[model samples]
Target: MKRILVSFAVLTSLAGVALADTHGAIAYSPSTSAIGWSYAHANRGDAETVARRNCDSSANDCRIAIWFRNGCGAVAVGHRGGWGSGWGYDGREAQRQAIRSCRKQTGSCRVIRWQCSENE
Candidate 1:
């Protein structure tokens, strides 16, 4: 009964970063409740691969929820089987957005994971 949506902002036009870009991605499987994440990776593809590969060890339906460069990302899960993800320049902002996004279709949701990676 889990519903998940992934944002395709990967390699977007405004994907340029500052001096250094530390890529990160978060993967989750609602069915198995498995979570995997990568931070400070070389590129988006690598970051996503690591996260998905890690989660794949435990989940059959794991999907990349969010990706970000030189920032933070978060995932929120609702008791009613709803999930959402958000990323921002900081952990608090990322978590806030994650909860807000989750509350869109759910009422009882809380953040399960969050991480930040600054440009090096």
Candidate 2:
């Protein structure tokens, strides 16, 4: 049951990331079992470009992705530039910290405008 739940949450998170439309935003939450994260690539174009932008932005924070595992959680909002470049932090701090770190890392990294709640 736990594995099934986790799998479902992970799948949901992946779907969200795949469908995300970049617009410069940051979001996050702490989870005991599972977590999620994502970034938007609006004007930036592709993941590489988005990663560069997120890293270049000076906002100091950006929304990543929505997540769910045991209870519920959000992805570690890395600096805008840390998206596709393999740069990012863990989901430890609150949503604000995640955004700050994400934005701090690169700057140009954009994220979804809003945080989406898990379906399950």
Candidate 3:
């Protein structure tokens, strides 16, 4: 009986952890870098706000907004000289450039697109 009870407790604890939302959803170009960039950002900080903002703005081409429960990291795309007047960049270079530029900002703004290039 003792062994059975102990096994049940362990299983229950494991199941709880498995069911938790441990990672955020990531999306990337089919040809460009990996899509799980946002997941990495969430791992470093809060994943919920990051996932919501990115997922919601994924379809839009204007502002690729990133939010955190603590703060925010964003890049103004589709603005002055922005891709397609804000439609945003279509190629990998454009995305990478944007991320690189965003990273230059001070504070938690280091997230800049939260990108990760496996090739690089």
Find the candidate with the highest TM-score and give its number.
Answer: 1
| Tens-digit lDDT track of model 3 for 1-120 | 999999999999999865543333223222222222244332534453454454434443322233222222223222222221011212244344445554444222222243231112
Better of 1 and 3 by lDDT: 1
Where in model 1 is the C-alpha error above 4 Å? Answer: 1-18
lDDT of each: 0.85, 0.36, 0.35
| TM-score for each predicted model, relative to the true structure | 0.80, 0.22, 0.29
Model 2: weakest 10-residue lDDT segment is 27-36
The candidate, 2 or 3, that scores higher on lDDT is 2
Clashes of each: 0, 35, 1
- Ranking according to TM-score, highest score first: 1, 3, 2
RMSD of 2: 14.5
**Cα lDDT for residue 90, model 2?**
29
**What is the alpha-carbon lDDT of model 2 when measured against the actual structure?**
0.36
Which regions of candidate 3 are displaced past 4 Å? 25-36, 40-45, 48-120
| Descending-lDDT candidate ranking | 1, 2, 3
Report the C-alpha lDDT of model 2 over 61-93, residue by residue, as the tens digit: 432333222122222323332532112222332
